[model samples]
Target: MSISPGPSNLYILARTMSDGHRSGVAAAGGMAIGSLIYVLLTALGLAAIFRYSPTAYTVLKLCGAAYLIFLGIQTIRASGAGNTSKPKVRIMGMSKVFKQSIVVELTNPKTALFFLAFLPQFVDPQLGQVALQLVILGLLYAILAFSSDLLVVLLSHNLGKWLSSHPLFIRWQDRVAGAILIGLGSYIAWQEFIQK
Candidate 1:
């Protein structure tokens, strides 16, 4: 699950392509923190709120979807503004990127749900101190995830560097990224409203 292709991974790739490796790494750090937060919440039994409260789950999903859509629109608009003599590279603050990544991770209720469902399978009642076991497992998962995201950041940074030289790629990259974000948001919304 740590290495799977999902919104978090795609966001990391897009940020690396658009900004730089530092931005991607910052985003990865935020994601790790977000995962840790979820783990803590799970350990505290707060994550069960989502499982029990349909309204809370729906609200979170909608907020996530809206945020993604907003980001997509912003990206697309930025792409349109870049029709100039030279391809402009937008310099985003790493801290801002990190915060946004955290928001993205936190807004995705599925992540909390995943932890709620996944972490208990390995837990042993015989061992006692179930909360400590959960925290340890969560920490291990976060570390592995951070490692995987770092690998992605390195590879995508290289690819972005290579692609930056091509004017066509430079022109289309933001549009593509925006489209992906929009698609992801729409998919999530669809899953929430249609499937549910």
Candidate 2:
């Protein structure tokens, strides 16, 4: 479930494809690094804070939604002025992508909650150091997630290349991506506020 092509992952892949395979790979790397941090934080008991504090979770969720909105607005603005033949002049660097992805992952409280609820079922207290065991499992999960996301990046990059050839698609690609982000952000807000 963790490795699934969620909204944030798809957004990162699409954004990175603007810069080619290298960017896609970097985006995947960033995502993996972010997930790794979440896993470690969950192992270290950050999940407890999320679980117990609804307000904290809500705050994080809103921050994530806001960030998505920001990204969406940026994409929409770029689409109007973007060129299809070459990479966008505003193409993000690996470090910027890394930082953005990490923040996005961190603000997603559900990832931490998922880790909290899921990783412990396999634990055996008899083996000793529970924290160590959790850490190992979390690292293993991170590896699996990275493997899956890398595959996604490769596929998305190819698809992006195909899309780039079509003049209409090239013109609309960023706009579509931006709209998706905005919709996802709205969905998150609805899930957090209306559903509850």
Candidate 3:
């Protein structure tokens, strides 16, 4: 969770928007939806494919890293060109934000792997339906993550407001997000390539 950029980037996106609360909620919702997909897939044993096929896992990691780098470049390019109105009109609408958040979450292959590895530890096949147990645990995690991310969103939004007076700060928000994303992507890619 700490290694992933989804929450931090979500905070950054929320900070730049006029309706921080709404954007934050939308982003959280999107992330939950994306995670739901992964959880479901993991419950269905799809993630076993990754565990059995090291090549597939590596390919997914590479793809995820590439996607992150792409997003970082896009954020950097859009930084200074975003909305200029009071409170800032938001670079994108709630729907777009929702979609972006989903994409960000979905592209991180590690999330699926995480759900696969983490949920089963809590499940007792003899106690009940394993699939149902996995889903329940996954939902609980999504809710908890969303709650934590909401706090981050609120805090970042308030900080954005405090920094809004300075155009430089406003302009740098996306740049900072972009840089972090790029760094994360590069690191992930490096780990995949170098650790083996």
- In every candidate, how many clashes are there? 0, 0, 0
Better of 1 and 2 by lDDT: 1
Model 3, TM vs. native: 0.84
What's the CA error at residue 196 for candidate 3, in Å? 2.4
- Cα lDDT computed for each candidate against the true fold: 0.83, 0.74, 0.70
After TM-score superposition, what is the CA distance of residue 144 in candidate 3 from its true location, in Å?
0.7
TM-scores, each model vs. reference: 0.92, 0.89, 0.84
Residue range 40-133, candidate 1, lDDT tens digits: 9888886577668878878888898888887777778878755646647665689988998898787765565668777878889899998899
Comparing 1 with 3 on lDDT, the higher-scoring candidate is 1
Residues 34-148 of candidate 3: C-alpha lDDT, one tens digit per residue: 7888788878987688778888878877877887787778767767565546455455678987787777677675575678666678899898788898888888888877776
The order of the candidates by lDDT, greatest first, is: 1, 2, 3
Clashing pairs in 2: none
Please provide the root mean square deviation of candidate 2 (C-alpha atoms, Å). Answer: 2.0
